[model samples]
Target: MTARTFQATNPATGQPLSPAFPVTTPQELASIVAAASEAARGFAASAPQLRADFLNAAAAGIEARAGELIAAAMGETGLPEARLRGEVGRTANQLRLFARVAAEGSWVDARIDHGDPSRKPLPKPDVRSLRVPLGPVAVFGASNFPLAFSVAGGDTASALAAGCPVVVKAHPAHPATSRLAAEAIQEAAAQVGLPAGVFGIIYEDGYELGVQLAQHPDIHAVGFTGSRTGGLALVAAAQARDVPIPVYAEMSSVNPSVFTQAALEAKAAALADGLAVSISGSGGQLCTQPGLLFVPVGQVGDEFLQQVAARLDATPACTLLTGGILKAYQQGAAGHLAKAGIQALTQGAATQIGAQPQLLGVPLAQFTAELADEVFGPISVAVRYEDLTEVTPVLAGLEGQLTATLHATDDELDGLSDLLHAMGTRAGRVVLNGFPTGVEVGHAMVHGGPFPATSDGGSSTSVGSRAIERFTRLRAYQDFPDRALPPELQDANPHGLWRLMDGERTR
Candidate 1:
């Protein structure tokens, strides 16, 4: 039987791009998994330097063909050239950052408890531990971040850095972009003399292929970024496996942005303008886009909202990444306004193809939990609160989030300890006087949160250096000969890693 093929569509024009990609058959999926399982042994055993070199080479390959990548991505994603270019750069830099961490050889966190031969009439056995790869991984490409979180994105980079072979299910939204990135990684793998299965990508437009990949016995872990439903599906598949594996799925977040009374008095216009940009940027497709805005209930708040409405009114409609997304946005916005007490503050001129940004408002007394649900486009809900304390309950009632932002003066913040603590409890990252759309990729960044924000119990991140730990598992060797220990844990410290020796940290 012939397998079905899918083609990328130019979201802006509703035109299909050239070169359709075939969906992976069950046979092909099995073969890919088998090869990756075989490659896992050699790949995981290779020295960290080899992995680092491969990552660097992949970054270089992507850079060499940046123009081609950016062009293809623009057509498929409807994103501006500047934003796509930046995404490409961020992707490359992310790979390089993981490469540096991989080569450093200390992120594995080697720890050794030296044997005590004569301690209180009892001998303490030596125990050494370090993180090891969890074998092959399955990565699901995300639609919003076609480059940075797709084929060779953070998941693949961190998995490969941890010495785990990766099989990525290319996002159908941007298959061409996925192919280009996959080619770079494949070239890098060949140049580094790694096995063919060290990195691979398959294309499909449905959920079955992704679930199959997650359920594969040889795939020991999964990385995903998408809707709550999609992430949970992968989680369910992994859990149903005979040997369940971890699924580090970053799912959903309605990143809440709050404005204190003082902040409104100080810079209402600036705050309104920034929030408009944050909500409408990239059609509000970002996972961290502020979905809810909290403002004080007063004349000042009404004035600020009016200013925000004007800015949003003047803002032109944006072409979303997909036609389906646009439809959903329209429907979502209409449904939101249909509810009692929920009124549309500003809804830009409607377009046949693009999404018109919208700002809706409802008093705290009528703010239902359903209203807080993410609309997934250029839309935000304005919740009017009588006092800062009045909104604390609302915050507590909400689900986990990627970020919670506060706009307030220094003096206002001094009295916001309890509010700040509440925000901290509900979100992974808290922002002060800044929007959450611009997520920085750094060691200190926490891109995952509790529950529906992520599926890994919020203990892991999908970005930064610590992301590598998601594909790793700690192994402790007790009472083993020095030669039997891994290099990082050997008595001689051959890897020159900083180890937690006995009760102190040392090299």
Candidate 2:
């Protein structure tokens, strides 16, 4: 039988884009996995500088084709030109950042302990340890981020930086964009003299191909960024494998933000405006959009809600990334509105072109278990609380979040310390007097959180320099000749990398 094929569609017009991509068959998947496995041996043995060079070349390639990439992404994702342009730049910068980490050669956390022969009683054997690549990795491109978290995004960059071959399952929403980005990486590999299987991309409409990729024995790890159901599915598949591999899946987060009485009194207007933009930006498709907002119940809080409603009333509707996402957003938002005591603060006129921005209000007393769920669109819930203590139970009931933000003054902080601490414990990153929609890519950024926020329960991150750690495993060599030791762990420090030598950090 012939393999199935699919095409991309312009979300704005609901018209299909050309170049139908063939579905990756089981035979094709097997061939790809076999090649990746063979390539992993040489790729893992390659010097950090070589891999770094490849990453740098890939970044340059993406930059060279920025216009084409951004145009393709804009049509498929229904995102504005400025947003898609920024995403393309972020994607290239991510590659260069990982390249820097790879070239530095110190991220492996090398450790060495010299043997002691004439000590009190027994001789201590020399031991050295460093991180090693976990072979080939399976990456699932995200529907939300067509570039920065997709085909040549952070996952692929960090995996390659850690010396692993990568096979990416292109997100069905933007296959053409994925193809462009994948081609850039392939060209970069060729220019750097890397093997053909060092980077690969395949297209499929549903979850079956991705599940097979996760279960493939040769795939030593998985990187995913999507819904909780999808992430859990890959985790289960990886666990069911004959030899289980790690799945670093960043799933869901409501990203609740709390406002203090003082904050509302001081700058309720500014806060309301900024938050409206954050919630409605990117059609509310961002993973870090503040899905929930808690505010003090009073005249100030009531007025603040009115201001937010006014801003949201003027906010325009936007086309979602895909038709399925649009349907899901409508259903989720409708479910929230149907609950008792959930009043629509401000709602845009519904349109066939896209989703409308919505703001719903409810008292903390009427909060329900269903309210904690993420609506995943241009929608946010504002809960009124008489005291911070009243929100404690609600906080406790929430799943782990990617971020928890506090809008407060210095005086109010002392009184809310316990509440702040609670937020910190439940979230991967805590923000003070700020919103969580825009995520900064850096060494200190933690994009993963506990339980449903990420499959690993905050043990790993899908962004930043440390993201390379997800594709690596620790290995130690004992009583071996210096020649046999990896350069990072060598006594002479051939790579000139920082190491924990004899329990002391040194070069």
Candidate 1 matches the true fold with a TM-score of: 0.98
User: Across residues 1-507, which tens digit of lDDT does each residue of candidate 2 receive?
Assistant: 777999889999999988888999988999999989999989998988899999999999999889999889998889999998898889999999999999998889999989887876888999889999999999999999999999999999999999999999999989988989999999999998999899988789888989999998899999999998898989999999999999999888889999988898899999999999989999999999998999888899989988988888887788998988888888898899889899998857346769888889999988887987987788899998998888766776789999999999878777887788788778898999999988899999989888888889999888799999999999999999989888788778878998899989988
Candidate 1 stretches with Cα past 4 Å from truth are none
Query: Considering summed lDDT, which 10 consecutive residues are worst modelled in model 2?
Result: 347-356
When superposed on Cα atoms, how far off is each prediction in RMSD? 1.2, 1.2
TM-score on alpha carbons, each prediction? 0.98, 0.98
lDDT of the candidates, in the order given: 0.90, 0.90
Candidate 2 positional error at 391, Å: 1.9
lDDT value, residue 343 of candidate 2: 90
lDDT per residue for candidate 1 within 69-163, as digits (tens), equals: 99999999999998988988999999999999889888899988988888777899898899999999999999899999999899999999999
Roughly what TM-score does model 2 have, to 2 decimal places?
Answer: 0.98
